[model samples]
Target: MKFQDYKVTDINLADWGQKEINIAETEMPGLMALRKEYSSSQPLKGANIVGCLHMTIQTAVLIETLIALGASVRWSSCNIFSTQDHAAAAIASKNIPVFAWKGETEEEYNWCIEKTLSGSDTWAPNLMIDDGGDLTKIVHEKYPGLL
Candidate 1:
């Protein structure tokens, strides 16, 4: 609930986080299978996926699936209260780059979204997946090339 830097390599914590992801997978059978298939196909190779969604188990699975599909993903929470602490832990465990947390103030929330939107030229997100259109608007206004 507080601000702290957690690296994905924190083995003990990451394992617990990974377990959370596994649990999420159980409830997301279709996405799990899709991730397996996409991992093999790599359809989104070289693509960056910037997502603005609730940081929950469901979202964690989707993030993993996107990586498995060969995407470089940057994820942030759509709502301050919607972050699943354990889900974020699990994602951080996998060493996935994520920025968002529960109980974020408006300033912190906007800062997270801004940070996620920053990217290298080619690696900048070509596709924006958002629940409320925040990411698209940010990119369109700040980094028009990504649009």
Candidate 2:
């Protein structure tokens, strides 16, 4: 999608992560089925989504599914240690604005979460998906107007 900004542990790991994402995709029936049914319809067209969850192979697959459904997204990890650099690489490789890595400090974790809320002037994220409450809390606390 050629996003203008993103942060990840390493772009070089994208190839390895893409392989993992490919494997995961094959195993996810529901998402694949949904993709097949909805890609052309693009029910999510013009939706802007921001997400905070564990960055993993599963998440990578889900991210792609969301894209296939036509939502533009920005994403981050909810927990510092829960991030998978390779998965982040895979997501970022698509030029999706993903901000995350493994083992972030408190500052970096917050920074990553904050980043997902940006591009508001351009993207205007209308949907938010978060594993823990952090992402949702941040939005309410710092970006109340978004609601």
Write down the TM-score for model 2. 0.95
Per-residue accuracy of model 1 over 24-121 as CA lDDT, tens digit each = 78988898888877688899898878888998888888888888888888888888889877777777666566777788888988888887776545
Task: Locate the minimum summed-lDDT window of 10 residues in model 2.
Answer: 1-10
Error of 2 at 10 (Å): 0.7
Candidate 1 residue 52 C-alpha distance from true site, Å: 0.6
Please provide the root mean square deviation of candidate 1 (C-alpha atoms, Å). Answer: 4.3
Cα displacement (Å) at residue 23, model 1? 1.6
Error of 1 at 72 (Å): 0.9
Give one digit per residue, the lDDT tens place, for model 2 in 17-116.
9999999989999999999999999999998999999999899999999999999999999889988899999899898899999999999999999999
Error of 2 at 35 (Å): 0.6
Candidate 1 global lDDT: 0.76
Which residue runs does candidate 2 get wrong by more than 4 Å? 1-4
The clash numbers for all candidates, in the given order, read 1, 0
